[model samples]
Target: MPPITPRKPQRRALLIGICYKHTHQDDWPELLLTHRDVDRFRALLRSRYDYADDEITVMKDDEAVPSRLWPTAQNIRRELDRLVRGTAAGDQLVLLFCGHSDQLDTEETKDKTEEDGQDEVIIACDAKRIVDNELKYRLVTSLHAGVNLTVRVLSLS
Candidate 1:
């Protein structure tokens, strides 16, 4: 009788790029190359990492894509949830963000873990901020055992 071979692990990715083009705030000016960065990263993942098109979820602010694909706080959270929804040991997950990020006062967030009293955040296209604590909870702590996660942040600001 032939022995059974082990199944290959599934690899999934979520890529986000926000330009904040419509934002009126002077502090949050429009970014020129975030969308292009996402495109190049996606291509790299496809070519080098063997990621299928359907395995990657891309969210960009400067594109005329579907509303669900927009880089809003809600959409980002939803996609993150989806990325880690179903999986077992050996699954690989990648999260890539290219856009603006800022540090907020911990007084506003009421999170005491920040030693500097500042909470790092990634700004969404709609000017919403996702704090580092929230990200750690969602992406780091929620993963199953042996699930490999790689996170890359390309902050222009």
Candidate 2:
């Protein structure tokens, strides 16, 4: 029998961290570590895992570069689509969300409800909430065969 060769896995990642600085007034305190954590993670991925700079997208609330991506619902959705859609069979997808997340348990919605009766949400930089169910539908459900998907949530509040 001929020896089998292992295929190299294609790597893609989306990193989101929000401090919610300009969103609200003195009501909710800002997160101090989220942005730095994302930076560290990005650096690690680039240095250790051999992931290219273009292969990873970083979205933060206080991003100074206007040309760079920000953490918004539409932007996140678009990047998620790109990461998932462009993946092949031996690809690896990494999604890391670090910031304020919410749990909404409302009886008003008809279609989207979680098993615990509370819908999980990730609060974006633009103060938009992206539901977990919507994420599942958009990113998870459309995963190609043999693609390895890993999701990590680091919530500070």
Which regions of candidate 2 deviate over 4 angstroms? 1-8, 25-28
- Candidate 1, residues 53-92, lDDT tens digits: the string is 9999999975586889999899999999899887768999
Per-prediction CA RMSD (Å): 2.6, 3.8
Full-model lDDT for every candidate: 0.90, 0.81
lDDT of 2 by residue, 1-157 (tens): 9998866778899998878786683433688898898999999999999899988988887749353477777888887888898666889899999888877775544444456777778887777788877899888899888999999999844
Question: Any runs in candidate 1 off by more than 4 Å, and if so which?
Answer: 1-7
Question: Cα miss at 99, model 1 (Å)?
Answer: 0.7
The TM-score of predicted model 1 comes to 0.92
Cα-based lDDT at residue 111, candidate 2: 46
Ten contiguous residues with the weakest lDDT in model 2: 106-115
What local lDDT score does residue 11 receive in model 1, on the 0 to 100 scale? 91
Model 2 TM-score, 2 decimals: 0.86
